[model samples]
Target: MKRKNVKLMMLAALFPMLCWAAGEQPISLGTPTGEIQGRVMLPDVERPPVVLIIAGSGPTDMDGNSLLGAVTLKNNSLKLLAEGLARRGIASLRYDKRGIASSAAAGKEEKDLRFDDYVADARGWIELLSEDSRFSGIFVVGHSEGSLIGMLASEGNAKVKGFVSIAGAGHPAYEIIETQMSNQPAEVRQLVKNINDSLRAGKAVNDVPVGLMALYRPSVQPYLMSWYRYDPREVVACLEQPVLLVQGDKDIQVSVGDAEALKAAQPQAELHLIENMNHVLKSCDTVDAGVQQATYTNPDLPVVEELLNVIEKFIKP
Candidate 1:
């Protein structure tokens, strides 16, 4: 649960698709919130299933970029995923959440970002595909933090034919945050717990620690509270369509236990655990901490074979 490895992969030497890459045509999808901007990569085949690629947390751009420094990986994981899926005859649509990239217009920006806003946005994408006769099926692929959002959005939506929860958390956001903060000093942990407890109780805390102000600040608390309300395990349990739950063992951001929890909630889900794969969905040995982390920023590395195989089998079979 501490790792985002649940974030995504498995294609080895699949660069052949790169030569045939669709190059991701720019797309502006209309939604209830506003205009959602993203790129659409289609396979050469006809009647392909369309995948809506949802990115993880933070300020991740459409191509899996974080303008906020510290994340230097320009490999374009989402873009590459779209390419790989396209090669396998699956088209994909990946976009920046509300205010990040092309969707940063005044009326459509993140003035008051909430968890449900993303869910609604995802449904908007589903509605778009439902109108397109070319796509016979619509799938929602949620990675890292997007797993929860995808699950909630696709659960009862008739337009979404399948759900893929990658590197998603099975626990509630409060428990996940608490697990992430386990190494913190007792005082800091208690402060976070108190704040979350108050928020869960439908109360807001005005006094906050300077150190944790960024995470629990007044502006972000409402979204955090909304996020904590939706338990991923509960959300997955409600999904009636086929589900593919995939996790990377060496993922530093998400843990295997989260995937197992998801499987427990939905016994029928097809679960695949990839060994030596990090959260970003790259195939490589995790013996060295630096190498493990390097894949996050490695642009040349391709998705592992195992990932592509399962995804293709799930969607085409």
Candidate 2:
């Protein structure tokens, strides 16, 4: 449960069958509004453990890529992660959340979207996997915002044997947003704080400043209110299954402190802090802004090896 440096070569030597072939198939789950789309990677083994991969926030797709304006943030983090797990003889399913990519049709109007909708979708996936005979165990791996969603869904679910939180925030969404805005001008920071406080209190602010409108807009306020209600530490503590908390020392978004807080909340949870891993799960040698940006946009980079190692051990141990 403590942080340790893992040698890639050593892990490779210990698990020699790291190149096993895995079959990829498109999977779907029907929701009340529409269908949620996903990909299932099944290794060539009978009754392998299946991990339900939940992606991060925003327009991120199943492959962990999101669109920023006209350009695409093309890191295939989740896709490569699923493939890595499959190669390790573990099955995985990564899905595009509603309002994202192929699942766009399943999205409701912004005002109608609530954080619990995502939790419901995750639970639906759990039910679908529970009835499948190919998978012997069910595990949930959530990254960033998805981490909290996975915790909520996995809590009290008998089918989920384990849970993994990667680059997940330990605090509520509002607090994290406030911390990220710490360097802004005092007035701007105060504006954001006031809005966040209102949202956290389940109240909607009608007049958001022009500069902050995109983030605190009236249409998105309801979803923000729903999201800010849950404290990640509290939720993770409620989970009865084994938990693995993984953080990257190099990650700028979610700090090592957040992972430590999560581990503290759940004393029995295992925690691993991988060296040089970034928010996108790729290894970056420097914290240079440009280099970090490149890691986010590069699709060729594989996820950090230590991450896959820690996860494999947690799932198979």
Candidate 3:
């Protein structure tokens, strides 16, 4: 009834400002902060399962690319995944982060965008999908930092039947930072640890080392402090539903060990490793650095069939 009317309005506006080509329709919904923009990609089949595609960190748009079309590493990974899912009769909704691209009006939340804000946005989108009668079930597919966001959003959410984590960080932010700082001087590592400790204890460190001011600056501390409280392993363990953790062997940003850690914490969650797949969801065979890096910019590359196959089975089943 109400859902049908909204769809009719969307359909009637086919000539005004909306484009519904191939079942992709622009959607805007009001939030407590502001309005968030997104695109709902629908399958031709009736009552298809709905999956919310949560994008990763930074100002990443609905397509897994940077906002305002920044030329650097503008890969259409998430966009391709939606198209791939549509081909298999699965529907998805992907959106720009607040203060990013079409969702710019939602910038009111960006300056103070703590990690929980992202989780709230994901939760809002999930509730929106539940309102639509054309969907059979709801699933959350989060990539990179979005994994944490989606996991937190699904806490006690009855509508979210399952979760798919793609290239998500396995350990907490502090541990990951420690691992990445292995090459830095021991003193630098120690300073980071002390700072992280203080923040974890709800104390802000006033004396940030000059060498590391860029990362530990006052402006970034609030968000960092909020994110420090979450441990991926701990969060995954608390989830009672079925979870799918996917990792690519060739990914440079997130390692296979991260996926393994999550699986270890939540033994119930099934883990799948895609051979030769990169972080961008592209299937790159070469071990050569040049070729592997090229995939980040290659928009035409089809998302790995194996990745799509696994997700389709997870949702449809």
Task: Give per-model TM-scores.
Answer: 0.89, 0.92, 0.90
- For lDDT, candidate 2 versus 3, the one ahead is 2
Best by lDDT: 2
Q: How close to the true structure is residue 165 of candidate 3, measured as C-alpha lDDT?
A: 96
* True-structure lDDT of candidate 2: 0.93
Global fold similarity of model 3 (TM-score): 0.90
Query: Which lDDT tens digits does candidate 2 get at residues 122-197?
Result: 9999999999877899999999999999999999999999999999999988888888899999999999999989
Which regions in candidate 2 have their CA more than 4 angstroms from the true location?
A: 1-22
Kindly provide the TM-score of model 1 when superposed on the true structure, using C-alpha atoms.
0.89
Candidate ranking under lDDT, highest first, comes to: 2, 3, 1
**Alpha carbon lDDT of each predicted model:** 0.82, 0.93, 0.87
Tens-digit per-residue lDDT, 1-317, candidate 1: 43443432223234334434444677777766568798888889766789999998877777776666654556577777888888899999999888776777613333277788888887878888788766779999999988988998898888888899888888998998998999999999999999999888867778988998888888777778777788899899999989999998988788899999999999999999988777778886774678676776777888776887888899989
lDDT of 3 by residue, 1-317 (tens): 99999999878766432422458988876787789999999877877898999998887888988644446677899999999999999999999987788888887533376878788889999999999877888999999999999899887899999999999999999888888898999898899899989888878888998988878887778888899999999999988778999999988889999999999999999999999898889998865678787788778888899999999988876
Candidate closer to the true structure by TM-score (higher is better), 1 or 3: 3
lDDT score for candidate 1 against the true structure: 0.82
Candidate 1 vs candidate 2, TM-score winner:
2
